[model samples]
Target: MHIAEITAVMKLPSNVRYEYFIKKVTDFEEVWGLFSDAWATSKDEDGNLFIPFFPKKEFAEISAEKEWALYKARSISLDDFIEKWLAGMKKDGIIPSIFPLGNDMAAVSIDVLLKDLEMELENY
Candidate 1:
């Protein structure tokens, strides 16, 4: 199957966040226009990554009891297009997520504008 857009959601603190377009990827208007949910979790967790596990689980488990599992998607191989897009995006300003990088307190964001990622399974 063909992938339209890729979004990698990550959590972050309330400050030091992304606030601009890194690159103008073609056919990613829908992804660019839509705002991805990112934020910090409660102060009880070991890590501050505020990932809502429900959505992830919904995209996993293929069972006889749910349809949300239909949203699950898998890739066949990491295509060169993804690398090219990421390189262009990095050059344009999109950088690696800072969750485990530079700072500990920063706003969360998603940055998967990679292109032409072949899908082996697009249950979604």
Candidate 2:
């Protein structure tokens, strides 16, 4: 069910995908990201490191390309995300790339993602 929904959502624009990412993560209490030797990361023009996350494993899996070719989709619990990952990433100056499809994504600050996730959780 969700797999099909995500497939359709993936075809939409990045902003819509980002909103779905937040909702699905909040609803499922899990986040998916690619991992191999270490978690996959990319740099913006300013050299800011970003770790892309998805609301579905299929989304993460599809993103595995080139440098991420050996990566596998890994799940992170929402509790860990809110309690540990977010703070650690904030301190490390890493941003979250939400629902990245191709080169387009919503790269948001840790604070913003934290707030959005918290707000989404409130709806449940």
Highest-scoring model, TM-score: 2
Model 1 per-residue lDDT tens digits across residues 3-53: 222122223231222221112122222111101242212222444322111
Alpha carbon lDDT at 38, candidate 1: 24
Model 2 — TM-score against the truth? 0.93
Candidate 2 lDDT, tens digit per residue, 4-70? 8767887899888888999989989999999998999999788989999999888888899888999
Which regions of candidate 2 fall more than 4 Å away from where they truly are?
Answer: 1-4
Query: Which candidate ranks first by lDDT, i.e. highest?
Result: 2
Clashes per model (N, Cα, C within 3 A): 1, 0
* lDDT of residue 30 for candidate 1: 16
Name the lDDT value of residue 36 in candidate 1. Answer: 22
